[model samples]
Target chain A: MAALLETLTEDQRDALKELMNIAMGQAADRLARLIDTLVILSVPSIRLATECAPDLSDCPIFSAPSAYITRQSFLGALRGEVLVCFEQDGADELASLMGFDENLNTDEHDELMLDVTNILSSACIKGLAEQLELPASFGAPSILATNSTLFDKVGDVINRDQTLILEICFKVESHSFTCDLLVCVARESLPSVIEAINRMLEDL
Target chain B: MAPLSDLLRAVIDELNMGVMIVDPELRLELWNRFMAMHSCRTEEDVQGRVLFDVFPDLPEKWFRQKVRSVLELQTLAFTSWVQRPHVFDFAGSRPITGKQSKMYQDTTFFPILEHGNVTHVGILIADATERAVQHQIMHDLNQRLSQEKVEQQHLIEKLEEAQNQLLQSEKMAAIGQLAAGVAHEINNPIGYVYSNIGSLERSAQDLLDMVRAWREAVEASGAPELVEKLDDLAKKYDFDFIQEDLSDLIAESREGAERVKRIVQDLKDFSHVDKAEWQLADLHKGLDSTLNVVWNEVKYKAEVIKEYGNLPEVECIASQLNQVFMNLIVNAAHAIEERGTITIRTGCKGDEVFVSVSDTGCGIPEQNLTKLFEPFFTTKPVGKGTGLGLSLSYSIVQRHQGRIEVESEVGRGTTFTVWLPIRQPEKQVDE
Candidate 1:
């Protein structure tokens, strides 16, 4: 309902935005360390959508001709999902930046992408939960789609209304490589997240 | 009811799944009846002992990380049997029918929180052996189905190719029948034309002789006026040239008619529509007829040479043998690039008659020599060949209890020699 959407006042929204930036910054640091390259992360933009279908269609990841999408689910206080979208050529760019000497076969390529997804999702979700004084447990990451632009693959997971969409872009400096990570908090977990954001706002 | 704690303890012990609790150091704090039954170690036996010390076969590194993740995050962590089966190394639930000796399990770890501090990790192990077995069976069935699908596709392609080849041979047989009918009709007309030309030649010669005799008598009669008049008329009409041209014209006409008769006879012999059964036949006559039958194909590409030796009559199906001969001769003609020689030789050794057709044309490659008789194998482009010529010839030769030998050198030439016995085997003769 619109009541749920307006629950996060301007000050709470600002606090949530600040928390997301700090969490994504930590994820970028971990990735940069792993690949031995400078990784630049954009300030995460947060939005609450009452309609599930329109939000995903408007996402830039689906605007791409094709992309490799990975999904990892987290449980406990921060129960939701994280989606990592690698552009059509993002896999090769990341592989090269990671100093893989030989061309990766299909399985190896999928494994590498999933590993990257795990590293990013675990780091970002854990960091965000810690900031909110909550615990987060991660499931195994899996490839959701390759060479597909259909939003249905991601839409089915975020079926409920009053969903929070957090979008961040990761870029490898000195390379044309870029990827998007979307953190979706399920409707059931929204109130706890909002309460945590309001608590942080009050403490400030 | 007893105290709530005691009631819960009883329920946990009687459950069908394995329940165990380990402290931060992985020291076992509790073990349920399900775990004790499978491991044969009661809670008292495993008390104060590390989980690995009790079960040495456990994957210590991976299990520790899974538990550590749950404890540090203070949340639940899980693993499916598909990801890692046999987490506990317990005996399988199904003793007799289960293929695996160890039970497949799906393990989950829950962090027990006290006052916002993690104290123990509760591990729950569920028996998934039946589901694992069913999944394996489904996987194996899927693999076999896909393999059979590939084999079915190949068989379909082979069947389609065989059908096409049969249709091609059927078309050739129909054409052969039509050619035989046409040859039979032409034979009658050719026969009369040949004989009529011979009779006309003789009649013309007789008339010329009579005129010559009369002229001689008149010249000898001593009538100067009559002789002078005859001489004048003969000179005016150029009678000498006419007499010479008349004999030449008759001879040429007879030769042409005779050639037509030979062509019709060649067509009849090539087809052998009337006498298709086994019989004693001269192979030399068959070879000559086959060569004439394919002469149009050869004339532009090659010259024909014959080296005939004495060949006793061979008992065989003449029509089938003619077909073999036609295939070989035509193949030889096609092998020639621009112009070459097709040498056909026939001879008899002991009771076997061998006929070889050699061509001085582009030779076959060494690799293709063995596959030459296999059906549907052709070097010729599509639509140019049905690839059944040599295969049909091979079968026909096999039916006659004969074999064809080939010798060739690349860029030089090829020779195909067919050897047949003078008589069919006694058993074959009876048939």
Candidate 2:
């Protein structure tokens, strides 16, 4: 696992980061359109590993005391899953943003979170797949954990080895709304992604 | 043999689930046998028609969005009966028992790709009525179980309260019986001792008078030798001291006997455990008897003052009222830190009589006043009080259709007043 990152040359890593930034930028735009607010998306970070566990010390979401996490899987030529991490009060923030403060019960809050997860994951995966020129399809997004930042849940959901993790952060301007999106590419499909990255590098 | 295409077509028609294909505009391109059998629309009847047009009950807006997403993302989309009970309102699969009138459906939408571009969407529907019914039954059972759990907890609390009350009352009854028995036994011995003292006092007075008269006669006779001898005997016998102390000794003995008799009478009146029925009784007598019964508890800590007023006979269980009075007096005595005063005041207004016991002891805090009558609520140290004293008193007063009111100021002292009607209502008199 430690040597997994050494396999990617500096050029390949940079190329992957650039692609992720574009993909995450598209996802942030979709969210902005959905909530009718400006969204700030940071530059995406890329990490590759041969096991499910990845060192998450530098990641703000994983290091936080607690978080609300949801997961969505995409299948076909591009296969992996995305984990959308929100702060503890993320439901209130999103509910206020969408003007759903009236009668937003617990079940409704979970539904809203899953809906947002679906939108963000599908949009982000679609963008990434478009750039790589591969077909991707999505499974339904579900709540993996709520008000918790336990890595065990993340590890259980992303059990495949030889994984590539793409990380990005989203912030709503002038609001306390922020979330992190961690996209994990599956083991069997890592070679295709690497091959695509190499092809992009050669073009560059 | 039939061609492979013909055989496949027949196989698709014979499948159990409802299978349909629709174009991008939701125009039905294919409908299977199950769809035709449920909707009562043959393929020829609904061919090339918009799906929503044939089935107006369908959630058109949501279905449209689901199909659009599946087409746009080229991904398989699904819905469970739990989330959406039915995509199409078909009759339930169970016809014999008729437990369900509406079918539950778990539907799925997937894109049909040709040459890598999506052209149509396929829909599959499966009957989920049995699973939905089972889940509903389980949920209802769980709700009832929790409700029973809560009721059981409440019943257990009630049983514990009743048991505690029985224990306290039983212990009190036994003590009352013992005190009455001891008072009865002491009454016999004290009665004889009192009469004997009365007879002795009269006899001694008569003898002394007679002796004095004789001595005067002897002196008049003027016998010098005899006079000298009498004087020597008197001096030797200390006759002056004997004459002075005899009356004093007799008086003290009478007073002691009277006190013992009064105490025995008070004990008999205070218990009345044998006569537990309600009667028209004097509250003053009950109060005095209760005071005497608890005097030992009060002597060291408090000085008691009785401020009595004329009151009508109150209809009540006399023994229970005495118990209440005893509890109040003892509690008043216990409240005093050093030496203080406990005052008993009685009065009448209208048809009600009131007796208030006031103490000059450290008063109860304002916050504790409300919970004073609650069972097991006490400020006294463990074993010093069962905390049932005031609660029992309150209930006894309530049983006579009376109420107890309390007033207190911290460090100033507290007063508890009980008020009862002069006569119980007619219905209670029957009981």
Candidate 3:
């Protein structure tokens, strides 16, 4: 990300970072309302990178096997897609939270896990829409790979350093949530995004 | 009131729905021919009267507001059980199809807006009697389908269980065959050993007889010397009764071994590995053997009072019925913890033979009585009850085209009456 940072002008980086700071706060507020909790948000730190390239193993949403990996492409000047995960331990916790006995049958457990993912992902998208000031609507997020299937397909494609990710943390009602906001550009949308931010800054 | 209008009025009157139209002041304007038939009120007296005065029993404020909302919104359609619970009984379609021609229980209230605003209201009431009956039929069909599906699943499970039992029985049969052969071989040796023991006893007896003869001969010829010698011999070895008891001890040991052989045969026959399907069986025979097996439990705890009446041979799955008997007998024993009585009576009732087992023990509580036939429900303490005894018996009896009923009072006793047809009745769920 530091090496990627050198590609962008100083003004562009500052604008992007400031934009991220506002976006993360908006995301947190949306979550706080729905769950009915006073959620405190930390401003996201923006970094210019071609890809998030997060440690695949660190993503608790996927098992080492049969995990579906999907990539969503949002079309616009400066568009980024989020990575949502489904993990086994997370499923166990989620099923318990849904008031299901831990000894639920396999299909019941699967349904509970599906509901949890749906709620979290939809909530996060609502937050993103609030921040971008863009008329944000979502298409269905597809499952890309199951288990470690993404690791092999994404092996060398994620090395780009020009992409930037704004990562934010939300603390609400004893639940800690981490939302990743990625802003990817094709060198063209980067300018538009910057201009939008400038117009925002001028208004501010 | 022309002839054409009269014809239309007659047609409307014959229709099933109750249609009533009211004017601006909420006075009934068109209490149609249909309303006259259902509400048992004619248009003449009901017209020009307030709806409240007509149907005074209608529930309160919110309902009036809902009517106003209908007039305000111009439409409303939803089932409302809130007004009263037995809503279905009030003559409305259960599941309406927007058709009010039939005797259905669905109701709809409509607002007639003349100028994009409410002017009058029409209430359409349809008799839901047929719809309710249809709904019940569909519901019963659904329940039967669900029950059949469950029974199908259980049948599959039962098949698997029976297959496993068959395999277990096969293994035991093989062991029994081997045991029968081995026992045959062992018997040959036993017979020889037994005969040899008998011969040895006889030889010992002969040596004793010879010794006795010599002693007697000596005593007769004798005099004081011989008599003194006989007395010394008697004192040296007290051989008084050894000759009389040795043979009896040897004979008893042989008889004990024969008893063991009979028990092994009974067990092998009980498993019945060679045959799988049910056969006609004598209930008395099955009951006697089952009683013998459970005797120890019942002997000290409860004296079994058996009154076996004349009964025809019953066609059934004998082993399963035996299992039912075993459960009931053991249950009776358990009920009578210390010295009580279990009275078992069998009699023919119509085309069925009824067996009733009554125990004078701690009876079931009324609260737990209904659930006694429910699977996995038990009043017995944990580890002491499987909760399957009565339920299993119930299933078995049902499978036999039979029914099981229990009557009991707390602290009094429990009596289980099972009725079985003389012939196999048509298959129910078990098939």
Candidate 4:
């Protein structure tokens, strides 16, 4: 489980976290601008994918039975999937902030979730890809499943044996909306991602 | 031989979903058969045209941003049927359901990368009308089921309430029948005992007069032996004191028996077993009789005050009206924790006669005032009240083509006024 973290030097891990922090900040800024509100972005954390799966029960969002999950696949120099989780109440708040109806029908809610996931995931992934000098293309964000089944569905998508998970939290200040974005990349893709980061670092 | 490009074009044309490719300038470059069928435009006619120019209803700003995102990020973007019902304005194909006239669409925009930069974007649109309709049907069914559940719950509550009312009335009817029988049975024995005491009083008076006459005769005859013997007998028997106390005892007994007879009569009147169902009756007489029947319950708790006014005889079921009065008066008594006043007031206004029972007791709270007549709604402790008194009174008043109104102040007191029509309506008799 610690092999992924052990493989990366402390300097490489710090550099990756810093890069994600900036990318997520840009994403949060885009959302804040879109909704005309303050968005607080959390410091990105780099961890092994296996560590996150087993500890998902400790996350407040996944503990709920009605958490909404959205998954989008990105491909380029680095290729993996980005999974975003929103608690039911947080999703409702986000929908309301996006000028959706307070009483959103199921279809409307699903659309809202996908729309948000598309906007944030694309912006953040694009920012990270651009910073690393890696051209990444993302697929259309699609709703996975809600509730406890989310974990099983996510597990089916990513290879748990060799994946690095970059966890980021996006919070809309003064609102009851928070979303967790987990970027899972295979260990095989990590070398290329690490090479891109090292290249950017040496250039700096 | 057909070229491979031509074969690929034929395959694309045969697909069911609409497919189109738009360049960076937003000009349509390729239009498939499905797009041509839905847009009603041939490939040659729309090939060089701007996308929005062909469909002016397209959300210009949103579509521009979506395409720009795909071009800039070189990533696929999506628009669901929920966001925009349809992009191409195609008619629904379902002839049977035909629930939606406009086709519901889920559209996708994918970047067609050339070398390293995207040159054109491919738009794929899938008809989602059937799925949308199915989802709507399911949502409607769920809403209807929830509404039906609510209505069913209300019906169950109503059935329970009706059952409670039936039980209360049955209990009251049984009590009423028993009271009528007991009053009748007691009336007989009290009547004879009263008559017997009257006769015995007269006989004792007559005997005493004869004894005095005999004594006078003895005195006139100057018979010393007989006078001495009579004096001795009088001293032994204390005859004079016996004669004095005997008449008083008989008179007291007669008074007591009279009281018993009056109580029986009052009980019979309260039950009104022999009275006609609907007749012209004095409200004051009903109030007095009901008060007498419940006097024991109120005497120690409150003082009774009657402020009578000239009232016309109201046509009603007197027994039921008396029951209402009994319920209200006893409720007033129960309300008062200590000595208070229960004012019985009566008056006539136009064609209506009003009787009110007012009490200087703990008043009903404002929140509970509206629910006062609801069955099983009570402030009294459990087992102390059946909570059906006011509800039954309200029903009884309604049956008489009348209304019961109440006014209360929290710390002051409560007044319950019942209004009865001077003449019972003919329609009420059928009810």
Predicted complex 1: CAPRI docking category: incorrect
- CA lDDT scores, all candidates in order: 0.80, 0.80, 0.59, 0.81
Q: Give the per-residue lDDT digits (tens) of candidate 3, residues B365-385.
A: 888877887666776789997
Tens digits of lDDT, candidate 4, A59-136:
443344547778888887778888888776536777655556678777767877886788677777877777777778
Residue-level lDDT for B76 in candidate 3: 34
Fraction of native contacts under 8 Å reproduced by each candidate: 0.00, 0.11, 0.00, 0.30
Clashing pairs in 2: A50-A162
Alpha carbon lDDT of residue B88, candidate 4? 75
Q: lDDT by residue for model 1 over A50-152, one digit each (tens)?
A: 4434666676554554568888898898888888888765466665543333577665566556646665677678778888888788786777887776366
Please give the range of 10 consecutive residues that has the lowest summed lDDT in model 2 chain B.
B1-10
Residue-level lDDT of model 2, residues B57-133, one tens digit each, is 88575577667656765656666676567679799999887588888987878888888777999899888898898
TM-score of chain A of 4: 0.82
**Individual DockQ of the candidates?**
0.14, 0.15, 0.02, 0.24
Q: Residue A102 of model 1: what lDDT?
A: 50
TM-score of each: 0.65, 0.64, 0.42, 0.71
* Order of the predicted models by TM-score, top scorer first: 4, 1, 2, 3
lDDT of 3 at A87: 40
**Can you give the lDDT of residue B205 in candidate 4?**
94
Name model 4 segments beyond 4 Å from true: A1-114, A123-167, A171-204, B1-4, B39-49, B86-99, B177-185, B208-248, B266-287, B307-324, B346-355, B373-375, B386-388, B391-404, B418-431
Model 2, position A185, has a per-residue lDDT of 83
